[model samples]
Target chain A: MSEVAVSIEHVSKKFRLYHERNQSIKSAVMRGRRSVHEDFWALKDVGFEVPVGSTFGLIGSNGSGKSTLLKCLAKIYYPETGSITYNGKIAALLEVGSGFHPELSGRENIFLNGSILGMSKKEITAKFDEIVDFSGVEKFIDQPVKNYSSGMYVRLGFSVAINVNPDILVVDEVLAVGDTEFQAKCAQKFRDFKNQGRTVILVSHSMTSVREMCDSAAWLSHGELVKVGPADETIDAYLDSLPGASAA
Target chain B: MRYLKEVLASRELLANLTLREIRGQYKRTIFGQLWSLVNPLASMLVYTLVFAFILRVEPEAGDPSGLDIFAVWLLCGLLPFAFFSNVVQQGMGSILGNVGLVQKVYFARIVLPLSKVGSVGYNWLFEMGVLVVVLVIFGAFVWPWLPLVVVTMVLLAIFAAGIALMLAVANVHFRDTQYFVSIIMQIWMYLTPIIYPISLVAVQSDKYGGLFGTSVTILDVYRINPLERFVAVFRQLLYDNRWPDPQDFLLCAIWALAAFTVGLWIFRRSEKGLAEAL
Candidate 1:
């Protein structure tokens, strides 16, 4: 019961910063090389772990590697070194409904997006009605998603992702979506998730949400782990370290 | 081996993505699924007109089947070639086309290109079915050779998927790959014995002796193209209504296996960098 849900050990991800946006054979041939580029380490020897049944937050300023680290965890980006080990099914809610084909109806996309998030067709079919109800787009479910308002599209996407029922859920800044009522519904769902002893790994810049929801948090600065401890304390330390922030 | 396991594990995603491609291909069009059939029919008409009527490129009648329809013979080669080019062209752009999905989601990246093969293969099946109907109507006993036609189709799909996988990853790094492949495909089509008979090349090779006074004839060099072997196999099975030459069959299998192996090797080596490259 005390085992960690996910562990990140000495993880480092390197990115190439291309000087020129020349992605063509002609350009490479003319330059006598594959364009000018420099190696930049996005996540440098950063390490952290999320305990089973705990809500975990990764907090960092812009370009501090929090998102990059989360991406590495989600298997979107493979790290150059180290390893990320996780137990059970991991579903990432990064850019919800990203795989939805615009020409496909909302009803069809549910299955498509569900499968993309690693859900089986049987599981999607079982949860179909609930997904539709949660999105509140029942009337337009049979219509092509291109016709849906942007809000409806995202809501449907979020609904399918949240219903994936993964043991470990990785979310990135998607909590601020939908109207206020939908937000309340999502908050309630997160509470239910915690009650069920599942794990949630979140990447967010909103310190208030981190302090309120996360049991423990890791603060990253410039691709390095600055601190890892209780959520409130870590958030306070991160906030105080800001350039012009006053001591509360 | 581990990569294959990963791809196998994601078969559901591949199936769903393929369905998406099939359904979304002509969603807004008035004809809808009929467009799949109409496209090949339209091309067959144009080629039959130019090559058979104007150019006078008359291939000999099917031997045992005794079917002399130029359009049918043209289709036997044209359909498979169309499928191959479609898979390569679409699969090359598959990763780039799904930038949102590739960047945000994580599944076997191979599924992107493989799904293109599946979708295009679906259309190819329909085209093949229509061709079979035409053959039966023309009094050709294609039923006996149907299994070989399927076997050849599978080999061609594997070969095309291999090329597609390599091109998909390469296209991610170099945006020009798609454009470059388009030109190559057009030239490649002419080089293959699709419109003209392979016998024409054989006769020309005999007349010209050898290439640069060497022993390698033009036909020998031409058959080096894997697609030539595939077209010949399809013609032997579907058009000629007979067992294909064992050498051609073995060579098709070899080219398919080699292309798939090399393509997958290249794809795996560069796959980790695709998200960043895009």
Candidate 2:
């Protein structure tokens, strides 16, 4: 029997969009609640399992619900009906350091971002040096993160998030934040995680990354799971099925 | 209750976010956090000048003697009212303002609103310190019921949190709610007895002339206006130095419950969509 890290059983998420921007007295009086919404499902009936120590890649076009499914697995959004049970701690780099304050120093951001990621103060203190070292921002640790380049900011965020030693890591196309060299380093880290038998759920549009890193691949199309299997075969099938694959 | 407990369990994140807010607002400013007290102090100065000197508004004829009675009266009403209004308006933007943060974590969503309570509490505490200094300077220290003022401020905070939670939820799905909040606050301020005693509007209507552009006391409008009782409670206890009528607390309890329930319901309903929208 496979040791499962995460189990997703028939999950779905729906969103309501409003045509009117504001619900003020004037709008309510004049427009009378302007034609609000028909439901839009970001995900529907998605079911999957990531066994312990396996690297699973999710590939889909934008707005195809790959990221939404990852979010549901991360518990960022609860499923409408079905349940997701996670066996161990999951650290998601959904958006690298989205909470970074403009005026706070990089050192301060490490603590803040670490805590925001659910790390205790004691954990931060213990791993502080390693995080700064990994970020390669020791020279600018005291400088406010706002002054850092986007690449530098992502390095700091990724370093902190990866160092959390989470059992399950959820990465959402954020690995492209830094330069190619940094991207290579992140990929190497993923390899190490894979070698050490940690579970990873990666959402990316890059077919190359999916083939290089993932043991298995899943293709999501319009909130539905379209394909799942071994990385090479599944990715080959997905690419073959694309609109202009034969012509290209 | 289970949700509240879950939020409480994430108290560290709430405190961290609140600290971020307090520091972020004043981080690079010259005076830093001292500005919290400076703002309310400045408003007190202007109101004291306008009413005591320009309009020559006086308390009822048989009011007791005190240090610079105008300042006492103005502060007595303004302090609690400002605290509540500031918390509410500031909190309207709190959840939406920090939508970015909420998108990243699995922490309790209530942390967003509760953090507003913390930051506003910080501001109110600073304002309270200034109030104490003012009392000392004006020799208004002998009031026997001062402890109850603490209770009043706490109630105002609960009331503020309740309203803030409602606004935070509403503002997320509806952008215009924030703008409407500003207009509502302006009108609500006038309806509240912060600038002038509600008793003045209640008892001496004929003497004051279409008082405040109406032939009625704010007390007469209490049923429609929620702030009436909250302001009346503070005015009674702080300005008159007596226990607030218990009826005021009852009304506050109702407002608190209503705002909490509606706000929580809206937030829970809307929260699932926050990630995509943000």
Check candidate 1 and list the clashing pairs.
none
TM-score of 2: 0.88
RMSD for all candidates, in order, please: 1.5, 3.8
Which portions of model 1 miss their true places by more than 4 Å?
none
> Model 2 over residues A1-248: C-alpha lDDT tens digits?
38999888888888766666444556666876655677888888888887899999998778899877887877787778788888998888888886788898998788788878888878999999989887888999999888999889889999999988899999988878688888888888899998988999999888888898999888889999998888998888888878998752
Error of 1 at B75 (Å): 0.9
Each model's backbone clash number = 0, 0
Tens digits of per-residue lDDT for model 2, B133-251:
66656655436656777776676777788788778777776678888889898888887767776656656554555547777644455435667777677666555555667888678
The global Cα lDDT (0 to 1) of model 2 is 0.78
Query: Per-residue alpha-carbon lDDT of model 1 for B193-212, expressed as tens digits?
Result: 99989999899989988888
Provide the overall lDDT of each model, using Cα atoms, as 2-decimal numbers.
Answer: 0.92, 0.78
For candidate 1, what is the DockQ-based docking class?
A: high
